[model samples]
Each structure stands twice: as C-alpha cells, then as structure tokens.
Target: MTAAAVVLAALGAWTDYPELVTLGLAAAATLLLAAAWLVASPKLTVVREVRPRRVFEGGSAQGTLTVTNVGKRDSPPLLVTETVGGHRTTVTVPALTAGHSCTVSYPLPVARRGRYVIPPVELGHSDPLRLLHRDRAAGGELVVHVYPRVHILASITSGGPQDAEGQTTSSAPLGGVAFHSLREYEPGDDWRHIHWGATARTGTVMTRHVVVPDEPRQLVVLDTGSAPYPSPQFFEEAVRVAASFCVAAERSGLPLQLRTTGGAQRESSGAALEFLCTAESSGADRGLAALADLLRDVVSGTQGVALTVVTGRVDTEAAQLLMSLRPRLLSVSLAQLVSPDNTLPARPRGVLTVAARGSEQFASNWNRLVLR
Candidate 1:
C-alpha cells in the first residue's frame, strides 16, 4: 500500500495532473497521520494478576489488569493482549484520567491442567485505519498452576508403616522374603517368588508373602508412556490417579516418592503436584522397566515402603515389572486409570489390579481393595 501510494504521487507529479496530485498528497498525509498516531507513545502503568494463582481444573479463575496513566494528560483507550498457556486473548482498556486508573477483569483458561504463564501484559493502540499499531510491555509475567482433578479416594491404609506422627497403616502380612512365610498364590503376584516345594507338598500354589512393619512411606508411580493409554483422556485419568495418591500421602503426613516415566522424580507433594500439573503423555518406558532402577534407589533409603502404580493399560510385561516390586514393597497396587469411555483392561495374574473408571468408582474400589 505504501509503494502504491508513492507511485501515484510520483506519477501525478510527472504528468502535472492537479487532481491526481491532490489525491496522492491526501493519501500520503493519511499514511503519515497513521504512523504518527502510533509513534506518540503514551505514559501508562499496567499490572496483571491471576486471582488465586493456582486452581484445579474444576474451578474457575480470572485475570485482572490494572492500568494507570502517569502522564500529565489523559490517556487514550488502548488494547491489552495476553497469552496464557498458548491461549491468547485481547481486552480493551478504556481511556483514563492522568491520576485515575481503570481495571479490566477477564476469565482465565482453567478448564485443563497446566502450568500457565501470563506473559508481560502488553498495552497497545492501533490507528483509526488499523494499518499501523504500537505495543509496549506494561507489567511482569505471572504463573498460574492448574492441577489435575483430585477426587476423594478412600485413603488406603499402608499396611507396613506406623508413623510417629500418629498415622497408622495396615500391618497385614504380605509376601516379602522366601521361606520366612508362604501364602496362597494371588493374582498379580510374582511367579518368581512362588514357593515350588510348598506348592508341591500342599498340592496348591503357595508363595512367600512376608511383611515387616516399618515407618510410613509410600511410592507413587505414573506411566507417562502414550502407548499404554487407550486415549488421551485415559492418560489424563492416569495423571489424576497419580495425583490423588500423592496428595493423600501428603495429607496423611506419610513419606512419599513420586516417579513418572517422563523422568520426573519428586519426594514431596508440592513438587509432585507441580509436575503433574503439566505432565504429558510420552512414549518412553512403555514397559515401565526404566522405573526399576528408580524403585531400587528408593528402597535403599527406606524399607517396607508401599507402592502404587498408576497407568492406563498394562500388558504382561508391564504387569510382570509391577509384580517384581512386591517383594521389596510392603504392598503393590496396580491402579488402572480407566476412563468411563475407554475399554476396561482384563485382570492380570500375579498382581493386584484396581480398575478405576471414575473418581467415585476409584474411591470405592480403592478403599475396598487397598484399605481392606
């Protein structure tokens, strides 16, 4: 457009056309005015804030922008642009008196789990023709953490640890060492731990299920592999499942360790929750074998820790990997985070499988299976 305008002006001058010259001059003046409109930067102050800096996916939140004109004259109406979690929005800030201020409130994107960042609030203005515009940073950035939906699950009594803080977990005898004790083989139990001699003598499957009481500590594992999930929603359910256990452990004042296949390892709920907020499905560690070393390192620091593994779907390899932790862990729980729309997974042998379809169902099933 600028080139065309200049061409018209030059052609008119070359042809000595008065009307064309007048038209060209007018167009040139319009362009100059447009450029000048934005060039005149105004003095204003901007502050952006996210109400309740953190929220759950089920909750509502808002972003507030405060604009103040510090100049000697009144400020013109300006547009404010914001981006949060790759979501962008524009808001109109009305003109303000030099000493006065204007506040604009907009809803935040909180329907999903993420660590959202509201970049520096941008104060901008466009010319009447909308051909020229100006933008300037007004305020610092802010972060809003939206965590996964945490459903009230029946707190599973960890059967191995009695915390000094008055938290008592289950003390039921579970298989740990060979020859120390033997119990009937159960689904999801490790076949390697099977007592072959006792089974032959009793004509029944009996395996070592030993339990040694210790301090209250639990491990929460989340499968970040995309292949194991039937759908994206199922993976989100897995995250929520992991989040529930992490928070529950924190609330109960129990020692906790959180591990994700994406290589996130945290010992506290604050760190774990932050990780889960932005956790994504990945293709790493499809069989959860990568976590074996992580678990091994965990047990070295603490003995008789309870284990909970959260994932979408588990195949034989994954199930076997989970079962392998039974001897070292006080208890092993395989939580299949099944969405209501996804297909249910078949029960795997030699492991405790809790098919959680929803928050309510998970609460009931978890309490019944683990709390018992």
Candidate 2:
C-alpha cells in the first residue's frame, strides 16, 4: 500500500496529474489515521500474575499475562514487550477473536540480588495496510525480590567479649557441661565438684572453676541503613562478616546468635545468608525487631554471649538498649574499623572500632580477630 502511494505521488509529480496527488494523500492519511486509532486503542482487559515471589541469584521464575479482547473494534496482530530490571523480552499476541482470552507466559532468570519491578507491557498494533502502528501500555507491574548468593563459612569470629568478669556467674551445678579443668582440691572443696571415683583412687580433693574458653557468647548485629547508599560491594562485605561470625561461632560449638538491626528472619546456622540477604534496611527499629525475633529462638547454652555490632551508624538509643542486655558489648562500627584519621565512637571500654577495606582487608581483619 505504501509502495502504491509513493508510485502514485511520483507519477503525479512527473505527469502533472492532480487526481493522483489527491488520491495518494487521502490513502496515506487514511492509513495513518487507522494506525493512530489502533495505537490509541484501549486494552479490553489485561491482567498479570507473578510466581515464586522470592528468588535467588541464578534461579528461574515465570509470569503470566492474560489479555482479553473486549473492544467494539477488532484489531490485527500485536507485539508485546515485557521489560524488567533493565532487560526486555518480546511476545506476539495474535489477532484476537471477539470475547476471546489469551495468556502469554515468559521466564525470568534471576541474576542478581535486589528488588525488581516489571515495567508496563507496551503493545504495538498496526493497521491492515501496515502503514501505521498504535502503541499503548497494557498492564500493571509485578515485583520480585532476588537474594544474593551466600558463601558458607564455619568457625568465624569477630572479637573477644569486652568484659570477661561481667560474663562470669555462679549458678546451680550443670552436669556434663564443665568447660574448665580442676586443680587438686586441698580438702575444703565442694563435694559436688569432686569426681568421687577419681578422688577415691587418687585419695585427693579437687575444686573446679568454670573453665572459660576464649569463645564467648558473641552477638554480631548488622546495621543495614541505605541512607548514605552503602556501595554494593561494601554491603556484601558486611554480609560476609555477619556470615563468617555465625559460622565461626557455630564451628567451635560455641553458643552463637546471628543478628541484624535491619530485618527479621534470623537463623542460627542454615538461616545466616537468607536472613542477611532478604532482610531489608528500612529502619533501626525494624531491623532490631527482626534481630530480637531471631534471638528469641537462639539457644546459646552456658556460654557468655557477647554482642558485636556491624553497622553504618550507632544509634545511641539502640546502643543504650543493648547496654541494658550486657554491661558492655564490643561494638565494632565498620566505618571506624580502621583508624588514624577516622573518628571513633566514644571509648566504650569494650567497644572496638574498625573500618572495612576491600575483600582482602575484610578477610585479614576477620582472621586476626578469630585467631586472637
């Protein structure tokens, strides 16, 4: 049709025929008007649904788009494009039958950990003459959360409990859970501390002071505020720290609790990464609430649980709340982790400030603390 119009216009221009020009103009205008009408055409009824609301990097999911033709006017074939997270996929919805419905399905390969909003579907339909096209946004958006990949770790450590004396306490004798060895008792020893059989054989008295292993009840609290926009790399570095801390504590069979002031859903061993990745950094209260929930289920046994916080900023109120839990905690702010020029938190005797470097620095600092 366009070729014919171009030929007619050319012939009119060459031979001075006015009818050919008028006919060509009318034909071109009709095609354009039809195309505009089709493009401006309202979607009869369009709906979208997403599956697997949550996914991990490298995981795959699907979505369904249902379109029903309810318009009084019939239309030709239309091409639909679905854009998500800067990626685009196209589908063709064939010419619809009146009152008929069609569903289109597409796959989304989860490649990164972040929230994604599916963009509106742009539908393009052209006129029968194929000289013009109409386009319109067809559907609402679907949101998906993609969590990052977690690297498993065991026997990780952040630092020592700020106060050793504060963690010690005398309680009812615990059976089969002695963490320390005993010295030869010189007679006035508590009978309960005596290994009767051994005492009888050695004919000696002995006493036991609760053996305190270097591993203390350590709590790693991560502050996940995106206020200043923590670099993606830095965010992941913090996650690795949280995970490593959990793994290290767990590996030593020390009572360990993984926490964050960013989101709930904390896990002891298997839940470290999920909690870290899925937890959102909306506010400190939200994050702390989530961390508290996680702590509720934690069983640290007899170890003196220490609190080590990893966060961007120190909420004084939050810190005060934590202080009530233990006299003092070894709070390490990542920004202040390294020092010389950086300002440090007020010298809370137990709190240690350390700055985070690259991956290598993170590992080295972690290793030093764990080894120490």
Task: Please give the RMSD to the true structure for each candidate, in Å.
Answer: 14.0, 14.0
Instruction: Give the lDDT of residue 256 in candidate 2.
Output: 56
lDDT of 1 by residue, 132-249 (tens): 7788887887888998988766555656435333322234334323134467999999898888999999999998765433455778888888887768887888888888888888
Leading candidate by lDDT: 1
Give Cα distance to truth, residue 75, candidate 2, Å: 3.9
Ten-residue stretch with the least lDDT total in model 1: 163-172
TM-score of each: 0.76, 0.48
What TM-score should be assigned to candidate 2? Answer: 0.48
lDDT of 2 by residue, 193-308 (tens): 76666667777765565533344555667756643224545555566566656666666656555666544435375566556555555533454334445445433345445565
Report, for every candidate in turn, its global Cα lDDT versus the true structure. 0.76, 0.59
By TM-score, the best candidate is: 1
Query: Where does candidate 2 have its weakest 10-residue lDDT segment?
Result: 331-340
Number of colliding residue pairs in model 2: 21
lDDT of 1 at 279: 86
